[model samples]
Target: MKILVYGAGAVGGYIGAHLIENGLDVTFLARGGHLKNIVDKGLNIVLSNQEKIVHPSYATDSLATLKNVKFDVVIVAVKAWQVRESATEILPYTSSSTLMISVQNGIDSPYELNDVFEARQIIPSVFRGICLVSEPGVVSVPSQCSWTLGEFQKNPTRAINSLLKPLIGSKLQLKVSIDEDIIKDLWKKLALIAPMSGVGALTRSVLGVCLEIKELRNMIEKAVEEIIVVAKSQNIILPDETLENSMGFYRALPYSATSSMQRDIEQKKPSELEYQTGAIVKLGKSNNVQVPVNSFIYYSLLPQELAARSDLR
Candidate 1:
């Protein structure tokens, strides 16, 4: 399988490293300083509990050089906002049977990429591995995280299994979920991440701190309820116990931990916020759903984000 792992930031880089470690056929698509580092020093991953050098892989920035190369799978790991640009740029790398996997966060990314290509051409999967790029080629993820795969249409057929075979058991836990209502599942996830990322970025604090504040806890519940209403309207049933379960795990996280979105916002780097909390507000308005908590955080964080960006210049 000729796999082209796009973006190679944290998540993409981590996945590529694992695939290469397992002796799978994979090449990284990266740019800028990350591209240079990968070309010169190869890729690196620092596990949550271990020393900072393990998996390795080759990388490059040239799509034209890989023009004749037909990738059996194209893992689109960039943020949602970059889907359009990435698709356009990498158009030549796709072939008829190329499985364009959407391993990004947010409900719209898979759909967004689908519109650019075809819905059937996309393999929608939720990756729970925690990854953050402290530098260009250095990627980090917790050792024991899991990844779930399912088609948007509910059937991860034989073809899907063939594609997932290489990634199944080598260092990453893979499961197949036959949930036809993936939209609801994505929304449920968004419901939690929306508030967590928003609050995390706004406060420069981790989830534990937010959970400690009575007011913030109410805000999070309120946001989840709003998302639940939207999910129910769309005919997706989410268990009432889901929120409590999510909160339990969230609060148990290390106090110093922060969302990748929060890290991007703090670093003044362009982030997936548009696909994170921003998507909720946008979708909520379109569906006549009110997401005040998310809206407040989205707008409030904008100025700080803008100020941070200005300092970069």
Candidate 2:
């Protein structure tokens, strides 16, 4: 199978390296420093159990090059903000039968993707893994990894098995669930991540840090409530017991674990304040839900970073 990894960051790198090992032809669409590094040293992926270095044919900074190319599947691993922009690149690489899987954070991606492509053509997928770009060409993280694929409508059988075929002898975790509540699951996952990561990123705190302040703990609880409210308003059915799930994950996760938001804040790079805290505010405003706390946290925490990214890039 021919595949293209549009945003070959940590998640893309992890999946691509394994796909290369499994003997499928893969290409990575990358640019700037990361692309430069990959061209120079190939792609490096370090999992807890194993390590991978794949040097497949690569393109540096151009999706138009993919215009003359063909791909059976295009796995988009770009950031949430980059999704629309990145999907545009796939126009050149995609054939009529190309399958697009959006394994992203926010719930709105599928609809956005469907605006350009058919809904039946987009697979609602999510990644339940911890991956970090430790350095250029090097993606490393601890080994609690999971990847799920499902159709947004109601069935997974038509959408997932062919994607699974490439995984027959690979070191990849692939699963197909027919859950009608995939969106709810995605929101539930975000609810957990946003509160934990948004609070942690805003405070520069870790999982262990949330344990210190009863007030912050309460704030975390409220942030989660805001997410749950939005989820319900969107007509997604969250598990009644879903509230504790995200927080529970925080407790079970490594104390030192930090979200991508926290990492971006520390690196002085652009952060996902909108999606985590910002999504809460955006969705809340539409539903007439007052998310003053998240709004306060987002507005207050983001200006500094906004000014900082300008200085850097």
CA lDDT, every prediction?
Answer: 0.72, 0.74
Shift of residue 273 alpha carbon in model 2, Å: 1.7
Q: In model 1, where is the ten-residue run with the lowest total lDDT?
A: 172-181
Error of 2 at 121 (Å): 1.4
**Candidate 1 accuracy as lDDT:** 0.72
Candidate 2: residue pairs that collide: none
Model 2: per-residue Cα lDDT at residue 152: 61
For each candidate, give its TM-score against the true structure.
0.87, 0.88
Which residue runs does candidate 1 get wrong by more than 4 Å?
Answer: 49-57, 154-159, 172-181, 303-313
Q: Clashing residue pairs, candidate 1?
A: none
Give the alpha carbon lDDT tens digit for every residue of 1-313 in model 2: 7888888888877777767777878898776787888889898777777676778666457776554677887888887767888778676678777778787786777777787777767776777768877888888867566666666655445645654566444364423343345677678778877777777877888867775688888888888887777777878767777777766776777778888877877777777666667888888888888787788788877776677567424
> Lowest-lDDT window of 10 residues in candidate 2?
170-179
Q: Pick the candidate with the highest lDDT.
A: 2
Angstrom error of the Cα, residue 225, model 1: value is: 2.2
Error of 2 at 272 (Å): 1.8
